[model samples]
Target: MSEWLQLPFVQNALLGGLLAGILCGIMGTYVVANRIAYLAGGIAHAAYGGVGLALFFGLSPLLGVLGFTLAGALIMGWLYLRERHRADTAIGVLWAFGMAVGVLFTDLTPGYNVDLMSYLFGSILAISRGSLAAMAALIVAIGLFVICFYRDLAAVSYDDEFARARGIPVTALQLLLIVSVALSVVVLIRVVGLILVIALLTIAPYMAEKRCRSLASMMVMSSLLNCLFAVVGLGLSIRFNVTSGPAIICVASLAYFAFMGWLALRRRA
Candidate 1:
C-alpha cells in the first residue's frame, strides 16, 4: 500500500477521488433535492456524444463531453420550463438520442480505437493532471454557486411555487442546476463511468439523508462518506490490481446495503 502510494499515477488517482468526492456530494444533493436522478442519467449518457465528437475533432474528450451535456441540459431545461407536463417525455427523448449519437459517432470515427470500458467503468489512474484541474475548477464553481444562491436554491428545490412567490428566478435557477449537473456529470464520468455515475451522484447523499436533520448537514455527511468510499475503494483497487472506478462505486454500494441492513435490524429491534 505504501509502495503503491509512492507512484505518481496513484497520487493522481487519490487527488481525483478527493475532487470527485466533493463534486459528487454537491451535485448528488442537488439531484436529490430536485428529484432529477433520471435527468442526471440523461446528462451523463448524453455526454458520450460529446466524447465521440471530441475524438473525431481531435479535442479534449472531457471538454467535448461537458459542452455536449451542458447543451443537452439547457435544451431539456427549456423544454421542461415550457411544458412541465412533458418534461419527463422530453428528457427521455434526449436521453435516448444522446446515447445514440455517442454510439453512432464513435462507430463512424475513422481508425479510432478507444476502450469503451474506460468510459463506462472509469480508469481513475488514467486521469491526467489536466482532468484534475478541470475537476477542481468545477468544484470551485459549484461551491461558489451554492454559497451565492443557497437560500433561493433551497426554496426552489423544495417548492417552485413558493420560490416564485419569493421572487426567485425559478427558471434561471433550474437552468443553472441543470448546467451544474452537466458539469458534475462530466467529472463523474471519469471517476465512475457513465453506466454507474448516477449511483455515485445519488447513493452517498441518500445514505446521509437518513441521519442528517438538515440539507447542509446532509451535504457535509455525504461528502465525508464519498471521500471515505473513494479512498477505501482506491486502496482496494491498488492492493488487488482492480479498476479504481468500479472499486469506488462498489464501496458505495456496500455502504448503501450496510446502512439499509442496519436500519432494518434496528427497526426490528
Candidate 2:
C-alpha cells in the first residue's frame, strides 16, 4: 500500500479524490439544504452531452463537459425557478434528453471508439495532473464564494421567504447555487462518474446535517467525512482490486445506513 501510494498515477488518484470530496462537501451542503438533489442529478446526467460534444469535436472531454453542464444548469435552473412545483417533470425530460444527445453524438463521432463506461462510471485512477489542477481551481473559486456569502446562502437555504423579506436576492443565489453544483458535478465525473456523483455529493452532507447544529459546522464536518470516505474507498479498491468509483460510493452508503441504524436503536432505547 505504501509503495503503491508513491506511484504517480496512484498519487494523482488520491489527490483527485480528496479535491473532489471537498468540492462535493461544500456544494452538497447547499444541495441538501435546498432540497435540490433532483436538480443536481439532472445537471449531472445532462453533462454527458458535453462528453459527446467534446468527442465529436475532438476537444478535451472535461472542457466539453464543463461548458455543456453549465449551459444545462442554466436551463434547468430557470425551469426550476419558473415552475417550482412542476420542475421535476421538466428536469427529468432534460435529463434524458441530455443523455440521448450524448449517445447520438458519440455514435456520430466517426472512427472514434469512446469508452462510455469511463464517463458513466468514472476513471479516477486514470486522472491526469491537468484534471487535478482544474479541480483545485474550482475548489478555490467555490471556497471564496462560500466565504463571501455564507450568511445569505444560509438564509436562502433554510427559508427563501425569510431571505427575500430580509432583502437577500433569493432567486439569484439559487441560480448561483445551481451553477456551482454543475461545476462540482463536472469535476466529480472523473471521481465517481455521472451516475454515482449524486451519492458522493449528498451522502456525507446528509449525514453531517443530522449531527451538526449550524450550516457552517455542517460544511466543515461534511468535508471531513467526504475526505474519509474517499480515502477509505480508494484504499479498499486498491486492496481488493475493485472499481474505485463504486467502492467509494459503497463505503459512503454503508456509513449512511450504519449511522441511521444507530440513530434508530438509540431512539428505541
Candidate 3:
C-alpha cells in the first residue's frame, strides 16, 4: 500500500478518483431524483464527438468534449419537454449519433487515433495536472450552483408542477440540471470512461437513496461510498495489474448487490 502510493501515477489516480467521487455523488443525487439515469449515457457518449473533434482539429479534447456534451444535454432536456418525442428516445438517438460522429471524425483525422480507447475506457493513472484543476473547478461550480439554487432545484426536482406554481423558472432549471449533469460526466470521463460513466454516476447514489431520507444526505453518503469504491477498486487493479475503470465499477457493483441482498433479507426477517 505504501509502495503503491509512492508512485506518481498512483497518486494522480487517487486524486482523480477522489474528485470524481465528489462530483458523481452530487450529480447522481439529482439524476436519481430527476429520474434521468438514461441521460448519463447520452451526455457521455455524445462527449466522444468532442473528443474526436479535438483530436482531428488539434485542440483540447476537454474543451471539445465539454462543448459537445453541453449541446447534447441541452437538446436532451428540450426534447424531454416536448409532447411528440419521448425523452428516452431522444437520448438513444443522441447517444448513437454522438458516438458515430466521434468515430467518423477520428477516421478523418490525419492518423488513426490510438488513444481513443483511453477516453472510451478511461485512463485514471494518466490524469494530468490540468485535468485535476478542471475537475476542481467543476466541483466548485456545482457546489455554488447547489448553494445558490438549493430551494429551487429541490422543488423542481421533487415537484416541477409545484415549483412552477411557486414561480420557479422550471424550464431554465431543467436545462441547467442537464447541463450540470454533462459537466459531472466530464469530471468522471478521465477516471471511468464513457462506457462505465453511468455506473460510477448512479451506483453510489442508488445505494445511498435507500439509506438517506433527504437528497442532501444522500449526496454526502454517496460521495463517501464512491470514494471508498474508488480506493478499493484502485487497490485491486494495482494488485491484479488490470484496468482501473472497470475494476472500480466491479467493486461498486458488488457493493450495490450486497446491499440489495441485505435489504431483502432484512425485510424478510
Candidate 4:
C-alpha cells in the first residue's frame, strides 16, 4: 500500500477522492436534510447527456457534464418551486430524456467506441490533474457560498415556511441549493460515476445526521467519513484487484448498515 501511494496515479486518486468526499459531504447535507436525494439523483443521471454531447461534438466531457447538469438543475429547480407536488413527474421526464439524448448522441458519433462503463461506473484511478483543479475550485466556491449563507440555508433546510416568514429569500436559496447539487454531482461523477454518485453523496451525510445535532457538525463528520471510506475502498481495490468505485460504495454501505444495527440495538437496550 505504501508502494502504491508512491505512484502518481495513486496519489491523484487519493486527492481526488478527498476532494470529492468533501464536496459531497457539504452538498449532501442539504440533499439529505431537505429530502432532495431524488432530485439530486435526477441531476446526476441527466449528466450523461452531457457526456454523450461532448463525445459527439469533440468537446471535453466534463465541460459537457457541467453545462447539461446546470441546465437540468435550473429546469428542475423551477419545476420544483412552481409545481412542488408534481415535481417528481417532471424530474423523471428530464432524467429519462437526458439519458436518451446521451445514448442517441453516442450512437451518432462516428467511430466513437469509447468505454461507456467508465462514465457509468467511474474510473477514479484515471482522473486527471485538470479535473482535480476543477474539483478544488468548486470546493472553494461552495465553501464560500456556505460560509456566506449558512444561517439562511440552515433555516431553509429545516423550515422553509419559517424562513420565508423571516424574509430569508427561501425560493432563491432553494434554487441555489439545487444548482449546488448539480455542481456536486459533476465533481462526484468522476469519482463514483452517475449511477453510484447519489450513494456516496447521501451515505456519509445520512450516517452523520443520525449522530450530529447540527447541520455544520453533520457536514464536517460526513466529510471525514467519506475520506475514510475512500481510503479504505481504494486500499481494498488494490488488494483484491476490484473496481475502485464499487469498492468504495461497498465500504460505505457496510458502515451504514453497521451503524444502523448499532442504533437499533441501542434503542432496544
Output the number of the lDDT-best candidate: 2
TM-score to native of every candidate shown = 0.93, 0.96, 0.95, 0.96
Instruction: Measure candidate 4: CA RMSD.
Output: 1.3
Name the lDDT value of residue 216 in candidate 2.
87
Write model 1 residue lDDT over 36-125, tens digit each, in one string: 887888788778878888888888886788789889988887887687777888888898898787777788889997777887888888
lDDT of 3 at 264: 100
**Rank order by lDDT, top first?**
2, 4, 3, 1
lDDT of 2 by residue, 1-269 (tens): 99998899899999988888888889889998888989999999999999899999999987899999999999999999888889999999989999999999999999987777887879899988878998899999999999999999999999899999999999999999999999888887866698667887799999999989998898888889998998999999999999998899899999999999999999999
lDDT for 44 in candidate 4 is: 91
lDDT of 3 by residue, 76-180 (tens): 878876632467877899999999888888989986654777778799888888888888999999999998998899999999889999999998988888889
Model 4: per-residue Cα lDDT over 102-201, one tens digit each: 8899999999876678777788899889889988999999999999999999999999999999999999999999998998888778666876578778
Q: Evaluate residue 74 in candidate 2 and report its C-alpha lDDT on the 0 to 100 scale.
A: 99
The TM-score measured for candidate 3 stands at 0.95
What is the lDDT, from 0 to 100, of the residue 120 in candidate 3?
81
- Misplaced by over 4 Å in model 2 are none
